[model samples]
Structure formats: structure tokens, C-alpha cells
Target chain A: MRIAVDCMGGDHGPSVTLPACQAFLTAHPDVELVLVGTADALAPAAAWPRCTLVTASEVVAMDDPVEVALRRKRDSSMRVAITQVKPDATGLTRADACVSAGNTGALMAVARYILKTFDGIDRPAIAAMLPNSTGGFTKVLDLGANVDCSAEHLLQFAIMGSALVAALDGKNAPTVGLLNIGEEDIKGSEVIKRAGELLRQAGAAGLINFQGNVEGNDIFKGTTDLVVCDGFVGNVALKTAEGLASMISGFIKAEFTRNAWTRIVALVALPVLNRFKGRVDYRRYGGATLLGLRGLVFKAHGSSDAFAFQNALQRAYDAARNRMLDQVRDRVVSALQAMPAAPDTARQAA
Target chain B: MRIAVDCMGGDHGPSVTLPACQAFLTAHPDVELVLVGTADALAPAAAWPRCTLVTASEVVAMDDPVEVALRRKRDSSMRVAITQVKPDATGLTRADACVSAGNTGALMAVARYILKTFDGIDRPAIAAMLPNSTGGFTKVLDLGANVDCSAEHLLQFAIMGSALVAALDGKNAPTVGLLNIGEEDIKGSEVIKRAGELLRQAGAAGLINFQGNVEGNDIFKGTTDLVVCDGFVGNVALKTAEGLASMISGFIKAEFTRNAWTRIVALVALPVLNRFKGRVDYRRYGGATLLGLRGLVFKAHGSSDAFAFQNALQRAYDAARNRMLDQVRDRVVSALQAMPAAPDTARQAA
Candidate 1:
């Protein structure tokens, strides 16, 4: 398998990317990496076996305007790495998948522009695997793709999410949760209510397993294998979870170091703390995938260290190797075909 | 000051409510509580010096529909308790404030029907005090009140939230963070972006301290004293935070009791763990207040025990004693009068 990497992206750029690639290559001897960036910076790491360099002159700054990254910097490493996944002359994909740690807006814009959206997907959604109490993960989307989504769009997200989870988790019929403010049938906005109905109908047809409305707490409870919501809500929930986890971790540390007796206790308590930390760490979950696209694209956190970035690469590799994209395409078609016909005269009338 | 208590609300109802009221009365030397519920159920608690009981025949079940609570159960304990704050004669407010540990929908419905909304406030927002890294708390609003809000309504939330923090946190010009998917000016949905502009204009006019756009993680970091968002996003973020905290706490306990060695460590680390737990405890921050109303009404967690319910009473007492309702009223008027006059040609051109 060949994977493309945006070597000039993220906080540490080549420094972190090169070392992580080397580790990844060592771990997966059968896999090769096409490192895309300024060749000079990445030349030192190209000596590794099965690793090749693809030069891209420009680098998308973390703070760059989306237009500048997409329009002005045509040769940006982020864009170049994504293009590597586009098929070559003989109809074979140049790179099976692509990974980037650049500005999310820029990366999404460039990828959407180059690879285009999937046939039935109105817009590609961002999916992140979140850790839950069940020791399993719940795949959530759109983490921050389109800010607003209609019921039809959310149905598309549900279908795409089910496909991705099924492919990754090896579950033939993963349950999908429609994230909402309340679990009641009468709760939520108009679009959310409509989305719930669509999911139910699709579930009844055996296209996907639709769990009824789920609240935010349900995400961490592992109530559903996949949770679907519009980008705005999903992104806020995802980030808020991160913030709280960090805050709690900080509180734990501060308490452990308060005094001599507490410091001594910290020594004995180190293992438990580490265990708790490991469970909530984002690095273990790796990068978020930009799903519902023609080609596979993964986004690493801009500040991810080598280990974290490597986890992202491994996740992307797993997605590509497991053919999540193919599953999504097939499932999207089936779900759409299975959708119940709409009521012809459903509008409120005299 | 006298506070009204809905003794028949919440998951535990009278069993938990009575004990909590007893604790609150014992802790405060001068404060009195008018416990509203079935006289048979609250008779034992009325023996205290200044404690009183007002009989109410009905109880609002946690699962009761809003209409049932508002229109059907007129003599329900929740409704009767809230009415204690209504002026009886000579335009004097009876009880300082009211609190309930009942169905949120039911409580809000009854409160709105009886207390009414503050002038110029389109709707009341649910404000919850969330623990932050700064050791203080951040007040977030519209947790699940108005599912879909106009930008104008969000601006109103910001104004009310600022007033809340100023009254409670005692900050002269508490910074208000407009929750969004991203921190950039151009990011987020159209409504969020418009809310940003409205907040900015309000800030420039000395109505608030707008800190621009903030992501979900900023909430825990306590980057701003208050964060305002539409109900949908706020509710998701709040619940997500709660779920994650509970999950983490669970993880900590499980890890500490994993084996003999871990158990020994847990014994040594008991103090640290207790301190950590206290810092993140939901009960410490109290309950969510129904803001933008003429009278203060707090909604305790449905399953709150005596400790949690008492915290709710204390928070409500603080709000009432500090005259939060009056402060919110004053701030809303000031903000409305300070709004910039619209340009004559600013409306969509013909």
C-alpha cells in the first residue's frame, strides 16, 4: 500500500513528520510513503527504504486565509499531498490515501476542489472517532464541514457514517445515533425531527441500524456505534469534550502536587493516573477523516506530535486497506434506494 | 430572605427535597424556606424555627408533558412554589426567588406562564455555571431553551449572560465569548457570524465585553467569564462536558480499584482524589437558572441528592440576595438604548 503525506504541514513540519514516517515505515514493511513537500527539508528521511519524495514548493501556513491556501498557493504541500490520491494514467489511484496536518479549512477546500464530492453526498463530512466508557469508540460527523445541514443532508451523513464505522469496526450493522438535545420523539429542531424520521425509515429497511434520539451524554456512554449531527453541533461537542478532559487532567495534576504528603501519594497514584489519561488521550484515536468524498483524506491535529501523527497515518492506512470509501459508496446507494417515498400532500392546509 | 422550594419535584421528590431544605435552613442563620408540597409529606420539616409549609395537592412528574404542568396541574408543587415569588399585595415581591428539582420543560413552562419574561427579552435562556481551569466558573446560556434562535435572540442572550456574570461573578465588564466552530471572524454559520457583529456593536457601546469568537475548548480554559450560543449548540456542549466528566471519573475509580497495588495507591491518594472530585463536582456549581425572566427560578438536576439540591438552593439564594433579576432588567434596558441606529440604506437594496 502507498500513502501520501503532507510533510510540510502541522506545527513541527518535517521535524515531526519525518520521524513519524520512519516509524510507520518500520512498523509496516509492506507499506510505502510518498512524502510531499520541499524535497530539501525531507531529503534526510528519504534514505529510509520504500520511502519516496514528491516535491511541492509551497506550504500552507496554519493561519493562512482559505482563499490564499486554495487559490494562491496552488502548489501547497497540503494540496499536493491530496492530489497524489487522484488516479493516474492507467486508472490506478496514485496514492491509496492522503494525510494532512494543515489548516482544516484550507485542506478541506483543496481536497474538495481536487477530488470532488461523492456521487450522492451533497458535501463531505468530517468524522472523528471518540473514546467511550465501553472501551470502544463512537464515530461522529460532521465535526466541522458544512455549518448547516438539512434533513436530507443529515440522512446522507448517517448513511456515510454507518458505512465508515462498519468498515473500520468490522460491524456489519453498526447502530447510528442521531445526536439531539433530548431523547424524546417530540424534541429538537425541525430538521432534526425530520432526520430522525429518515433514519428510522432507513433502519426499518435494514440499510442502517438507527437508534432514536440521543443526548450529548450518550456519546461517552457508547450508546451507539456512530453518532450523526450537523457540523456545528458535532464540532462544538467534540471540542468541548477535549476541553473538559484537559481541564480535569489539569485538576488531577494540581491536586497531586499540592504538598509533600500529596506528592508522595502521586508516586503511588501514577499508574492509575496514567491509565485514566491513556483512556482519554486523543493521540490513541488519531486523526479525523474527511468522509463522503470521492477519495480518502485524513486530517491530523495541527499540533500533533510524531506519535499522534503516526496514529493518524495508521488510521488512514486502515481506512484505505479496509476500503471504507468503497463501503460508503455502496451503502449510500443502498440507503438512498431503500428510502421510503415522501408524502405527496404533506403540507399543512385547510 | 425567604426562598420558595418545590418539595415534590425531581427524581427523589420529597425524600431528597425535605432533607436538603433542612440542611439549607440549618446552614443559613437568617434565611427561611417556604416548602411547597403536600402538607402530609412536608409536615416533619415545618418544625424548624422559620421554616414554613404551603400545601399543594399536585406534583409535576418528571415525565409530565409541558402542557400538563403548565395548564393541567395548576396546583402542582412546582407551580405553587414559583408563585410564592409573585407579589401578593402593594406591588411587593413575596419570596426573593424560587427553585425546583423538576422536569426542565415543566419548570420553564410554569415559570414563564407565571413570572413572565423580562422586558425586551425575547425568551429566557437556561444558564449553567460550569467549572473551569481558572478555579472560577464560566456561565454559559441557552443550554436547551429555544432550540432555534435568531441572531437577535443570541445578542439578547449575550446581554443577559453578561448581566449574570457581573451580578454573580462581580466583574465590572465580564468578557462574553460567542461560541462558534472556529475562532476566526469569518468562520461559523451565518447566524453565528451575525451574532458576532451584534456582540461587537454592543461591546463598542459599553453594553458588554465581547471577546470575539471562541471554540468549544475555550469554555474549560475560562477564556471568557461567559459564553453565549443558541440553545442547540449550548445544550450539546453542556451535555458532552458532563458525559465526559462522568466517564473520566468512572475511569479513575475503576483504575484505582483494579488490583491490590492500585488499591494501596488509591488509599494513599485518597485526599488528592477527593480534592479533584470536589473541584469538578456538578453540585458545587449548583444548578441551571432560567434567565431573562422577571423572577429568578433555578432548576436542579433531576436526580440530585440532598447535597446537590442544597447547592441549588444556595446558588438561588445568592442570586436572589444579589438581586440578579433586577440586574438583568437594568442591563437589558441599557443595552437596548445603547444599540446603534441602523443606517437608512443598510437594508437589502431594491
Candidate 2:
């Protein structure tokens, strides 16, 4: 399997991605890496075995706008890497999947422009797994992909999310929960209420396993295999979790290093503290998949180190090997065909 | 200042509230307490100094629906306590403010029914202070009060939240941030975008210290003194934070108690760990204030213990003493007067 890597993306650029690529290639003997970056950035990977270097002239900055990445920088590394996944005139693709650790907005825009979404899907959604209390992870979708989603759009998210989870976790018919402020069916805004109805209908039709409504706390409680919400709410919840984790860890560090005596105690409890930190570390989760597109594309955190970026590469390889794109296409086709004849009327009635 | 206590509410009922009342009374000798509950529940508080016991026939269950609390349980302890803050025929209130640790929905419903909202404010909002890294609290509003809010409603929330911070924290010109998915002006849904425009207008008119747009992480970063959003988004963010905290603490405990060796280390590091826990404890932040109403009402967490309940009472006492209601009234009147004549048109343009 050939996977394209955006070597010049992320905050540290080559310093992080190069080492991650080396580690990933060592671990997977059957996988080949197509390193895309400027000549200076790709020089380190030139001698690597089973690696093909494809040089680009430009690099997308971490803070560059979508327009700059999409229109201005035609030969940017991120765009070049994504182009490797796009099929040519003969329907032959150079890489099975693509991975990038760059600006999220720019990456999404460039990916969508190069390899448009599937026929049944209107927009691609961002899906990521958050660690849950059951020693497992819960996959949440629409994480800032499309802020304003219709009921039909949410139903599509559920179907696509189910396929992605099934492909990655080998969990067929993963249970899906519609995220809301309350668990009751009557709660939330008009859009959420409508989405709940659509999800329940989809469940009845055996398109996806819909498990009624769930509150934000349920995301970490392992109440369902997947949680679906509008991108706006999902993004806020994700960022809020990130912020809280940072604050709690900061507080722990401050307390441990407050006094010389406390520092001694911290030294004694180093093993316990490291174990606790490992369990909640976001880097271990790897990357977020941009689902519903024609090809597989994973977005690593912009500030990812070598370890995190390697995990993203592994995630993309696993998804591609498991035929995630085929799974999504099949699910979307069947789900859309099974939808009601007058979905708009049904939403209005709801 | 006199504060009414609903002894029959919350998970522990009188067991928690009675002790909290006693502690509050001891802390403030000049403040009086009006204990409202069933006759049996108020028996312990009858002999307390500077306390008045008012008998109510019914009690609101923690799981009771809003309709039941608002209509069926007219004499519920939660209702009776809120009634103490309502004006009588002679325009004299029995208590300056009321505190309840009950079902949040029922508390808001009953409080709104008894006290009603101010003229310029369309709906009441739940405002609570979240601990920030700066060691100060960021006050967030519309936390599960109104699921759907208009641009004008968001403006009202900013005004009320500002007054609330000024009254409780003594920060006269606290900055207000409109919560959105992104910091950019063109980001987020239509409602959020319109709310941003209205907030900027309010800032220009000197009605509020609006700080443009802020993301969810800003709540903990202390980027602004106040964060305003629709109840749906705010509630999800708050609960998401709560869920994350629980998971992290649980992970820490599990790690410490995994085996004998870790347990020994935990024993030596007990003080540092305890200090870390205390820093993120939600109980220390006390209760959420029901803002934009004519009378003052605070809702503590339903599962609050005596310590948490005492903090809630202290918050209520402080707000009452500082004349929070008058401050909110003045701010709302001035803000509404400064608003554009065609708010709907302005929203359309946005």
C-alpha cells in the first residue's frame, strides 16, 4: 500500500514529520511512503528504503488562510500530497491515502478541491475518537466540518460515521447517539429535534444503529459507539475538553512542583503520574479522518510531535487497508436509497 | 440581607441543606435565613438564630418534570423559597434572594413563574463562574436556560452577565465574549454571526465590554471575563468539561490505587494530589445564578454536599448584599435603550 505524506506540514515541519515517516516505514514492511515537500525538507528522506520522494516548491504555513493554500500556493506540499490520492484520467491513483498535519481549514479545503466528495454525500465531515471510561474510545463526528447541518445532513453523518467506525474498529452496526443538551426526545432546538427523528427513522430502516438522544457527558461515559452533532457544537465540546485537560494537567504540575518537599513526593510518584497522563494523552489517539470524500485523508494535530504523527500514519494505513472508502460508498448508497420519499416534508412536519 | 433556603430540594434534602444553613448563619451574623420546606424538614432549623421557618405542603423531586413543578406542585419547597423573593401586594419581598439545589429545569420554571423576567429581557439565563488558569473565574451565561436564543436575546445575556460579574466579582467593566466555533467574524452559524454583530454594536454603544468572538477554550484561558452563547451550546460545553474532569480524576485514582507500590507513592504524595483536586473542584465555584429576572435566584448542583450548598448560600447572600438585581435592571434598561431600532433588519444584513 502506498501512502502520501505532507512532509512540510505542521508546526515543526520536517523535524517532526521526517522522523515519524522513518518510524512508520520501519514498522510496516509492506507500506511505501511518497514523501511530498520542498527539496530541502525531503533531503533527509532521500536515502530511506521503500520511500519515494516527490519534491514540491511551496509549503503551507500553519496560520495560512484556506484561499492561500488552495489558490495562491499551487505547488504547496499539502496540496501536492493530496493530489497524489486523486485519480488521473485513466482512474489510476498514485497513493491509497493521504496524511497531513497542517492547518485544518486549509487541509480540508485543499482535500475537497482535489478529490471531491462522493455522489450521495454533500459535505465531508471530520471524525475523531475520544478516550472513554470503558477503556475504549467513542467516535464523534462533524467536528467543525459543516457548522450548519440540516436534518438530512445529520442522517448522512450517522451513516458515514458508522461505516468509518466499522472499517477501523471492526465493529459492524456501531451504535450511534444524537448529541443534545438533554436525553429527552422533546428537548433541544428545532434542528436537533428534527435530527433525532431522522436518526430514529434511519435506525428503524436498519441503515445505522441509532440510540436515541445523549447529553455531552455521555460522550465520555461510553454510552454509545458514536455521537453525532452539528459541527459547531462538536467543535466547542472538543475544544472545551482540550482546554479542561490542559488546565487540570497544569494544576497537577503546579502542585507537584510547588515546594521542595512536594517535588520530592512527585519524584516518588513519577510512575503513577506518568501512567495517569498516558491514559488521557490526546496524541495517542492519532488523527481525525475527513470522512465522506472519495479517498482516505487523515488530519493530525498541527502541533503533533514525531510520536503523534506516526500514529496518524498508522491510522490512515489501517483505514486504507480495511477498505474504508468502499465501506463508506456502500453505506451511503444504501442509506440514501432507503431514505423516505419526502424528507423535506417530514422535516417540516417535525 | 435575608436569603431563602429550599431545604427539601437536592439529592440529600434537609440532610445537606440544614447543615449548610447553620454554617452560613454562623459565617454571617447580620444575615437572616428563611427556611422553606415541609414542617418535618424545617424542624432542625426552627431553633436556629435569626432564622424563620415557613411550612410548605409539597416537595419537588429531583427528577420531576417542569410542568409538574410549575403547575402541580404549587406549594413545593422550591416554589415556596422562590416565592419569598417575589414581591407581595405592598411591593415588599420577604427575602432578598433565594437559593435552591434542585432539578435545574424545575427550578428555572418555578422561579420564572414566581418572579417573572424584566421588561427588556425576553428570557432568563443561567450564569455560572468557571475557574480559569489565571486563578480568577470566567463567568459564562445562558447555560441551559433558553435552548434557542435570538440575537437580541444574546445581547440581553451579555448585559445581564456583565452586571452579574460586576455585582459578585466587583469588576465594573468586565469584558464579554460571544461564544462561536471560530474567532473570525464570518465563522459559526447564522445565529452566532448575528449575535456577534449585535454584540459589537452593543460594545460600540458602550452598553457592554464586548470582546468580539471567542472559542470554547477561551473559557478556561480567561480570555474574557464573560462568555455568552445560546443555552444549547453553553450547556454542552459545561457538561463536556464536567465529563472530562470526572474521567481524568478517575484515571488518576485508578493509577494511584492500581497496586501496593503505587498506593505507597500516593500516600507520600497525598497533599499535592489533594491540592490539585481542590483546584478543579466544581463545588468551590458554588451555584449558578438565574439572571435577567426581576428577583434573584441561584441554583446549586443537585448533588451538592453541605460544603457546596454552603458556598451556594454564601453566593446568594453576597449577590443580595451587593444589590445584584438593581445592577441588572440598570444595565438592561440602558442596553435596550441603546440598541438599534431595527434589530431584525440588522440581523438580516449580518
Tens-place lDDT per residue, model 1, A83-177, is 98987767678789999888887888888889887766777788999899998998998888777677877888888998899889899989899
Candidate 1 reaches a DockQ of 0.53
Model 1, which residues run further than 4 Å from truth? A338-350, B339-350
lDDT of each structure? 0.86, 0.88
Query: Residue B159 of candidate 2: its Cα lDDT?
Result: 91
TM-score of each: 0.96, 0.96
* Candidate 2 per-residue lDDT over residues B46-148, each given as its tens digit: 7889999999999999888888988899899999999999998998999999999999999988887788888777778899999999889999988887876
Where does candidate 2 stray beyond 4 Å? A340-350, B340-350
Worst 10 residues of 2 chain A by lDDT: A341-350
Q: Could you tell me how far off, in angstroms, the CA of residue A277 lies in candidate 2 after the best superposition?
A: 0.8
- What's the CA error at residue A198 for candidate 1, in Å? 1.5
lDDT of 2 by residue, A241-334 (tens): 8988888888899999999999999899998999999999999995899998888899999999999999999999999999999999999888
For residues B1-350, write the lDDT of model 1, one tens digit per residue. 99999999999999999999888988998898889999898888866778778999999999998889888899999999999887765857668899899998888878888988876776788999898899989899888877767777888888899889988978879999999888878878777888788889888888988999898999999999999988888889999988898888888889999999899888888878998899998887759989988788999999899999999999999998788888998998887776533222111000
Candidate 1: TM-score, chain B only: 0.95
Range of the 10 consecutive residues with the lowest summed lDDT in candidate 1 chain B: B341-350
